[model samples]
Target: MAITLSERAADHVARFIEKRGKGVGIRLGVKTSGCSGMAYKLEFADEAAPEDIIFECRGVKVLVDPKSLPYMDGTELDFVREGLNEGFKFKNPNVKDECGCGESFNV
Candidate 1:
């Protein structure tokens, strides 16, 4: 099980961490919300928890809690800019269905 960051995403995250001056990496997880039952959560990790499952992608660490691993396995994160708006996108293989608005998913 692994979560990878595209080159653009890795560079984006690395820039943020550099600006913040304290983050060791980024954390990825799932939460029980949104219309489709689950949603993605992200945060800057100052340090890795002992039990976290870590994957290295493009020189950045992508940290995942063991519980969130199943849902996020084989997911690739990408950073994109579409005209005026830009943000992180999740390409998750485990997603069976997603809300029409693209905010949530169910396995």
Candidate 2:
């Protein structure tokens, strides 16, 4: 039961945290939206909730709510740059299928 971050992702997140100057870490979760019924949500966490589970990867902290863990366990978050397009990508072993737009998935 854990989430991981690629080195590039950790570097990117660390830089963002440094620029913003006030964040405990990044939070990762799932929300009910998009065509596939679930979409990944990522945000900066100023602090962890009492019920949140934390993972340390690449020297960066990753926070997750207890409820979101089942859906995101063993997920690896990666930062990618492809020409003019770049963003965070999820390599989720639990994902059964994903929407054509690549914005959502179902497990």
Q: Estimate each model's TM-score.
A: 0.97, 0.97
| lDDT (Cα, tens digit) per residue for candidate 2, span 1-107 | 99999999999999999999999899999999999999999999999999999999988999999999999999999999999999999999999999999999999
Pairs that clash in candidate 2: none
Model 1, 1-107: lDDT tens per residue? 78999999999999999999998899999999999999999999999999999899999999999999999999999999999999999999999999999999999
Question: Quick one: how many clashes does candidate 1 have?
Answer: 0
**Full-model lDDT for every candidate:** 0.95, 0.96
Candidate 1 matches the true fold with a TM-score of: 0.97
Instruction: Quickly count the clashes in candidate 2.
Output: 0
